[model samples]
Each structure stands twice: as C-alpha cells, then as structure tokens.
Target: MDYSLNEVQNSIKNNFASFCTKEIAPRAPLLDAASHEQVQTMIKENIKKLADIGYLGLAHEEKYGGTNLDLLSQAIAGEEVAKACASTFLSAGASNGLFGMPLKMFGTQEQKEKYLPGIIKGDIIGAFGLTEPEAGSDAAAIKTTAVKKGNEWILNGSKTFITNAPIADVCLIMAYNDREAGPGAGVTGFLVEKGAPGFVVGKPFDKLGFRGSPTAEIFLEDCRVPESAVLGQVGAGFIQAMQTLEYGRIGMATVCLGIAVACMEAANAYSKERKTFGKPINRYQEISFKIADMMIMTDVSRLLIYRAALAKEAKDPESAVLASCAKLFASESATKISSMALQVHGGYGYIKEFPVERLYRDAKLGEIGEGASEIQRILIAKSILSKIH
Candidate 1:
C-alpha cells in the first residue's frame, strides 16, 4: 500500500513542525531545568498552547471540541511534538491521547459530554490509571477492587507510575469488580474525579526523563463513585484497556520516531560544522555512515508508524500486531540512533546543552512504556503463531 502523504497530511506535518519548533521546542530546556512544581505549571501551559491551536483534538471528532482528523494525522502531529520536546509530548500524550481516546471509544454519550470537551480544551487534564504497584505488563493481575455498595461502588487499591497523576482533573481507574469472573470478565473501569473521597494523589516522582510530565502514585482508600462513573459496563475494563493500548502503541511509536529524527538531525548538522583533521567530520566514512544509517532507520520507522496508523483507521485486526512491531522497532532504533548520533558529536553530545543529551534520556522510556520491547515480541510472536496453522 502507498505510504505517501496526501496534501492534508503534508500540511499537518509542516504546520505542526513549525508550531512545535517555535512554541514548544523552545520551552523544553526550561522544563528540564525547572523544579517539580514549576514543571507541572509549564506542562499545563504547554497543553493549553497546543489546545489553542486545536492540535490536541486532531484525532477526535468535532462534536467533542475536536477537529476530527484521522489517526495518521494524529501520528504525524505527535511525531513533530516529540521531536520538539519529548517531555511535553509525554505529558500531553497522556492527557489527550491516552486518557481521551479510551473515553471517546467507550464512554457513554453523557460521559463524553461531561469529560471530552473539557479534556480536549486542555482546561481539564486527564489521566489513565491502569499500571498498579504490582500490575504493569501483567495488567490482568491488578489488585484494585471495585465493590458495589448500594448505589455507589467502593474502590480500594493503589496505582504507581501514573502519568499526569498529580494534576489530573479526572482519571479512569481499572479494577476487578468480580474477581471470580476471571481477568477477561471480572475487571471494570471507573471514572473518578479529582477530590473524590478516598481518592488521593501522591507527590510527583522525580523521573529519569520526561521530567516535565509529572508521574506519581494514586491511592484509592475506599474511594466512592456513583454507578454513572463506570466506564461502559462491568467485566469490560480489561478488554477496554487492551484495545486502548493498541492506539497508545501507535502514539508511543510515533514519539520514538520524533526522538530518532531529532537525534539524526542534530548529529547531521554537527557533523558538517565540527572540523577534525583539517576538515569537517562528514568527510570521514565512520561519521557519514552513521548519519546514513540514522536516516535509513528513521525512514523505516516512519513507514511502520504509518502502516500501523492506517491499519488502526481501517479497524484491521492486524493493527495490534502492527502497533507492537512499530513500537518495538522504533524504540530500539531510537536508542541506537541516539547513541550513534551522540558519538558523531564526540564529547559535545554528552553535555546538557545539547538536545541529544535530553533526547537520549527520553528515548529510553519508549522501550519501557506502552508494552516494552520484550512484551511486544511476545505479542507479535503470538499473533504469528496463531496464523501459522
């Protein structure tokens, strides 16, 4: 299938790149330098800036304060954002892409009306709380429980590594409502708002990277919510979470692509400017080959991202496998490309002043987030074996 960008897609890429370079990229260093509280404020401002341009709503329908663009357009915009500033990309992606997509896909019309508009506008930040203290890749093992008590459900458990936890206005919490029903049929999702009784947000964690995106622990000590807060129906949360991750995988892959592109550009530009042995480093085969490989890798990653996005848009069942493949390849490529790109810069790349330094840190999360490289291989292999017969 053709992967060429149409006029609209090209336009989105150009426009988003320009906006991110001018508006978002400049703030990345400031974010990296700021304190936790300061970073939180800056992250909110970044989301609003994107929202003002309707960038946050690219993939969502217009009825919910969105622009109704396709998933490919969303991926393109995400790549630009990540390239400009991986930290902003992470925080904004969690709020708009991760949190909003699930609600759009499963929430009732009323639920959408209540949350989507505020979320898309960036007025109300959102977060997805699925990774618990014990349940990460094995999401089915979540210890959180939602027990029915009269007209309300009482939730009790804790989630760690929740992005946007400190500032989330609303959070979609996953828990087992009927443990006896098994993971496939026992789990349920709940829409819990900020300040709900027994819902406590812990202090933001000092992370290794994506520092501007505040991640923290969430404790639900007998958290109470009305029946209306249930996301879709009982015994559906696990399925909803898995399906939502498919879209998230595509987004994460695009984020990795942005980091890879940034590293490649930085290294390529430095190669021409930095002189060694009476000539530019580009003259050396070692440097030039590294740059070439970076280019090739980025191109391949982009193609995979597009393929996955297209598959998702068409509702292809293979979309899940494609997404995992994209994430696995792009994330690993980004780390390798960043390392080589930094090497091309020599000692200069190791400095904090260089974008590659921060990008190097940001590239790592892609391998850990979404589903991790190992998890992705399992998924891809399982899908392949299922078709072998």
Candidate 2:
C-alpha cells in the first residue's frame, strides 16, 4: 500500500547515491575510455570498492557477510550504482546477483559455506553461463550437455556473450542431463572453476558499449566435475534459471531506470546551459518538451521498478508478470530518453567528450539483454490472454 520509500530504504538510496557520486562516478569516463584489458582491471577494482561498502551483498543474508537489506533497498542501491556507471553495475550484478544468488537460493550447505562469503567479500568473481550462440532468448534451446560417468559429470558446450566471463573465477554452467525430458526435467546446473580441464574462456569481445563489463565466450569440451558440483536438485536447472532471471529482470529494470535518470539530468543541465538566439535553450519549447518527457519517463520507470521489487519481495503470484512489465517499459524508455538527451547536446553528444554518447550506446543493451522487448510483450500478452474467459 505504501508508495514512498521507508526510512531505511531512503537512507540506503541517499547513502548509495552519495558514495557512488564520490567513488564510482569519477571512474566511469576512465572506464569508458580504457582498453579491454585495462577496463577489466578497473572493473575488478570497482567490485572491491563496492564490496568494501557492502553494496555487493545487498539483500543477502548477514551470515554471509552481507548487508541484509530488503530487495527494494537493493534496487535503490542498484539504481545509484548504475547511474554512476552502467558497466560496473552490470558486472557486479553478474557476479553477486546472477551467480552468487543462485547459490544462496539453491546451493547445498557446503556450497554456501565455500562460495557465499568469498563472493560477498569480492575475493572471487562469478559468471552465469546460460545463453549460447543458439539460445539467446530461448534458454531451453541451449545445446550444452552434461553426462554422468562414474562419480563425475562430463559437460560439453559453449556459452556466448557471458558477462564477466573473461575474469570469472567460477561459473555456473547449465546443460541438459536428459535431453529427451526437456528443460523442465532434463536440465542441470554445475559449478565449474576457471581452470577446470577443457574449460576455456575466450578473449574478451570488443563491444560497442558496456566496455568496462567484460563479455566473452566459454568453451567446455568434456569438462569434468565431481558429483558435489551439482548446483541444486537434479533435473531442476530450468526452474532455477527461470527463478533467477525473474529476480534479474527487476535488476535490469532498475539499471535502465538509472540510465533514464542520467539522460534526464544531462538533458536538463545542458538545456539550461546551452543557448540559441541569445537565450538559453531551455526557453525553447522543443528542447523543454524533450526534457519534460525525459523527466516523466524517469519518474514512471522508478514507480514501475519499485512496484515490481515490492511484489517480488512479497512473493506475489503475479510478480513475474510485473517484472516483465517493468523491464519492458524501463528499458525501452532508456533508449528513448538517452537518444533525446544526446539530441539535446547536438554535436557535443555525438563526441566521446560527452557522457551522453556512452549513455546512448549503453542504453541499447538493456532492451536486448536480460530479456528482449519482443519477448516481454509475448509474456505479458500471454499472461493477460490466459486470464481472460
């Protein structure tokens, strides 16, 4: 019933915004301009910095060296971090939120004891390997296969566009254990270490945006792991992935919201500072309306994101539907808002000197990554149609 953030959530929002402004924002341009190798190192440093402030462990259990904040609080922190640097936010989430959260949610006691603390401490980097060359949105179409032999599991496949792949110390690899049974009952997830025999991480890709967040391919040819490497119950990988992605969608939305906010700020500031015909551009209706639309989208996206976050935290039955809704709106809004912001800057936005150029490029991945806007529409439409008589 509440529409506003409570005291603790507000405090988290303010504190994270302040810390990110002071520590993270300054490195954003540096990260954007760094070489692939250099950016990877800088992102590692950003991860450690986030860990030092407990941002890496937001909403996780206190026993695991986490801050134990609520999901809404975590979303708040995510927005601030993403507003500072989208690449850092994406990389950090790939580690703790995507990789570590699965372990926390489904890992055995020993798994938690071994990985959670180190992951939260930022001592170990993690990656989630699910999307393959063929299975970008259709996760069930992954060609990876795992077969049990004696006391070990042998895995073989490749994952592309994996976040943090170039630097991950550990990865959760999903594959089919019984292809005939389909993803719901056939798939399994295994914890594979970086140097495991036959497991090779390819060179980082030269990306158009999010250059600081290293993305690469993972090749596993007859990769072997002990029986203890299973992530959760046998035949539960598809459900686990679905569950993880539902939560991840909320994160994706928050980050997009952050990008929208950044766009609005840039546009508003530039409109007031830049002048045309001896008057500030803000006085022009064309410039003023674009800024107005940016403000409206940013505000609306925040509400949608928080609504989804609250639904998720409450374990609402319709949470998945809401998550998709938020993600679709926020992500598409980001692309629109960023373009407007860039247009507001005129020639300066096209140049690398202005952050809007980077924001424009970074805003695009949101619509495609996590889940595509097309897929979101399908899900939302299906959910609605399923309810009608």
The RMSD of every model to the true structure, in order and in angstroms, is 0.9, 0.9
Which lDDT values do the candidates have, in the order given? Answer: 0.91, 0.91
Which residue segments of model 2 deviate by more than 4 Å? Answer: none
- Give the TM-scores of the predictions, in the order they appear: 0.98, 0.99
lDDT tens string, model 2, 56-167?
Answer: 8885788989977778888899999999999999999999989988898899999988888888888899999999999988999999999999999999999999999998
Local accuracy of candidate 1 as per-residue lDDT tens digits, 87-203: 888888888877898898899999999988888898999999999888899999999999999999999999999999998999999999998997657999999999899999999
lDDT of 2 at 371: 86
Superpose all Cα atoms of candidate 1 onto the true structure and report the RMSD in Å to 1 decimal.
Answer: 0.9
Scored by lDDT, model 1 comes in at 0.91
Clashing pairs in 2: none
